[model samples]
Target: MSRIGKKPVELPSGVTATVSGQTIEVKGPKGARSFTATDDVTIAVEENAVKVTPRGTSKRARQQWGMSRSMVENLVIGVTEGFKKELEITGVGYRANMQGNTLKLALGYSHDVDFEVPAGVTVTAPKQTEIVVEGTDQQLVGQVAANIREWRKPEPYKGKGIRYKGEYIFRKEGKKK
Candidate 1:
């Protein structure tokens, strides 16, 4: 049995969930999100909570049981509280600023990198070295932050690049001359 799957996801006040066939939809103050579970698991909303159960005693069914439960939990969190990812830029002259829906990044490149913000996700630069990605969809928020960090991943040598806030770069000893 899956530990996480055994726990039902509680629906907080002002939030609601509905199940249609294999799909579960959750709506809250932030937004509404849905997930379609595979046939290996079953989804249902009962008594102000969402539950997931494996279809049979199989490895795939057990795997999907836990995964489907977590997915439903994420949907509830996403609609209620949403998700956020923060990025920090380290290096001289490297900075980020939001210009409308475009993110202008100066990552030591000769030309500035303009990243067009996609729909549903909001990108903001609270400071020159800080970038904040916010959205109801956890996957999209993380992907956008990763894409932004890809432009200038933190190097182990000098650690000069963009990285997740509070992320530690493993330092490597330089030339021992």
Candidate 2:
């Protein structure tokens, strides 16, 4: 039995959920989101909470049991609190700024990178070296942050690059003199 799958997702006030076939949709103060689960699991809403249960004792059913529950929980959280990802730039002369819907990044490149922000997500540069990505979908928020970090991944030597806040880089020894 999956520990996480055993618990039902509680629906907070001002939030509501609906089930249609294999799909579960949740709406809250932030926004609305839905998830379509596989046939390996069954989903239901009862007593102001959402529950997922495996159909059989097979491996795929067991796997989907936990994953479906987590997905449902994520939907609830997404519609309510939403998700956020923070990125930090660590390099000389490196900085980030927002120009309308575009994110201008200076990662030591000859030209500034103008990243066009996608819909359903918001990117903000509170400081020159900090970028904050927020959205109701957790996956989108994380993906946007990763895409920004990919432009200038942290190096092993000086660690000068864009990285997630609170992330640690494993340093390597310098070449012998």
Candidate 3:
């Protein structure tokens, strides 16, 4: 028996969930999101909560059991409160700015980096060194932030690059003179 899969996802007030075959759709004040589970697991909306169960006692089924439940829970949370990721830019002359849907990044390079924000996800530069990614989908929000950080990952030596907020870079001693 899966520990996490045993508990049902409770629907918050003003949030609703519906199951259509293998797909589960959740709607809340923020927005509506859905997910399709694999055949290894069964999904249903019972009472004011969503439940997930495995079809058989196979390894794949057990794996999908917990994953399916977590996915359903994400849908509910995503539709209700949404997801957000924050990035911090370090180093001199490194900054970020957002113009409409395009994000302009200056990371010690002569040419500015232009990142086009995709649909559904919103990127905002509240400050020159701060970037905030927000969206209804948790995966999309995290992926977008990761893509942005990929342009200038924080280095261990100087730690000059873009990184997630609260992330720590392991410093390495340099220059054995």
Candidate 4:
């Protein structure tokens, strides 16, 4: 038995969940989110809680059991509180600013890099060195943060690059003369 799948996801107050065939849709304060599960698992909502079970004893069925349960839980949380990711820039003259719906970044490149913010997600720059990404979908928020960081990854020598707010970069010493 899957430990996570065995536990039903409880519906918070003011949140409603509906299960139709293999699809489950959750509606809450934030918004409505739906997830379609594979035939390897069966999804049901009972007593204001969502439950997922494997259809067979095969490995694929078991795998989908846990994953489906987690996805359902994420839907509940997404429509309620949502997800957020933060990024920080380091280095002299490196900064970020917003232009309308686009985010302009200065990372020691030949020219400023303009990143167009995608729909359904909000990007903000409270300070020149800080970038905040928020959205109802967890994957989208995380992917946006990673794409921004990909522009200038933190180096082991100088650690001069964009990284997550709490990320730690291991410093490397220069060659001995």
Candidate 5:
């Protein structure tokens, strides 16, 4: 048995969970999130806890049982606590700014790249090279951050470009004479 699967998911106050067929929906103070479980996985929501079970003893079912449960549990936690992703610009002229609902990024490009902010997500630039993305959905927050970072990935030579906060960029040595 999976230790994570055996652990019961504790529901916080003001959060509601419902299991309908293969779909599990969790609503919290921040927002509501839902996910569909595989046929082999089953979920049961009680008064203040949620339980996950495998429908059969097959290996496939056992594998999916814990995975599905953990996913559901994360959805619940995500809706309640929300998620955040931070990015930092590492170049001299590289910077990020927000105007209204649009994000303006200057990453040494001739023209600035403007990204539209999606609903339920907030983008903030605490400093010229710092970006903070906040949202209730973990997937959306991470994807957006990744997309932004892709615009200008850090280069090894000068360690310049956009990168996640606390990310390490291995510096490369100069060419030999």
Candidate 6:
């Protein structure tokens, strides 16, 4: 038995879960998210918790059981508490600003890069070098952060570019004379 799959997922207040065929939909005050379970995995919603079970005893079934459980649990939590990702710009002229529903980034490039914020996702720049992305869906929030981060990945030589807050970048020293 899978340890994680065996544990029941507790349902928070104001959250409702419905299983339709192979898809499980979770709705809460924040928003709603759905995920489909694999063929070998099954999800059961009880009074106040969710249980996952594997149809057969096999390596693939075992793996899908745990993964499906975790995905469902994430959907529940995401709809309830939401998710956020923070990014920081590092460079002499690198900065980020939010205007309306767009994020403008200056990453030492000749032209500024503008990214349109998708509906249901909020982007805020507390500081010129810091950006915060908030959304009720975990997958959307993470994808938005990654798209912004791709604008300027950190360079090893100078450790300059966009990076997640508290992320460590290995710096390479300049060659000796």
lDDT of each: 0.93, 0.95, 0.93, 0.94, 0.90, 0.92
lDDT tens per residue, model 6, 60-160: 99999999999999998889888999999999989999999899998888999999999878999999999999998788899999999999999999999
- Writing each residue's lDDT as its tens digit, candidate 1 over 1-177 gives 899999999999999998889988898999899999999998988898888999999999999999999999999999888899999999999999999989999999899999999998999999999999999999999999999999999999999999998898999989996
Off by over 4 Å in 3: none
lDDT of 4 at 68: 95
TM-score for all predictions? Answer: 0.98, 0.98, 0.97, 0.97, 0.94, 0.94
Q: Give the residue spans of candidate 1 off by over 4 A.
A: none
lDDT of 2 by residue, 57-134 (tens): 999999999999999998998998999999999999999999999999999999999999999999999999999999
- State model 5's lDDT: 0.90
lDDT value for candidate 6? 0.92
RMSD of each: 0.8, 0.8, 0.8, 0.8, 1.3, 1.3
- Model 4 residue 137 lDDT? 90
lDDT of 4 by residue, 46-144 (tens): 998998989999999988999999999999999989999999999999999999999999999999999999988999999999999999999999999
lDDT computed for candidate 2: 0.95
Q: Candidate 4 regions off by >4 Å?
A: none
State which candidate has the highest lDDT: 2
Candidate 4 minimal-lDDT segment of 10 residues: 44-53
For all candidates, the clash counts are 0, 0, 0, 0, 0, 0
Clashing pairs in 4: none
Which window of 10 residues has the lowest lDDT sum in candidate 2? 73-82
lDDT of 3 by residue, 1-177 (tens): 799999999999999988888988888998899899999999988888888999999999999999999998898889888999999999999999998789999998879999999999989999999999999999999999999999999999999999999999999989998
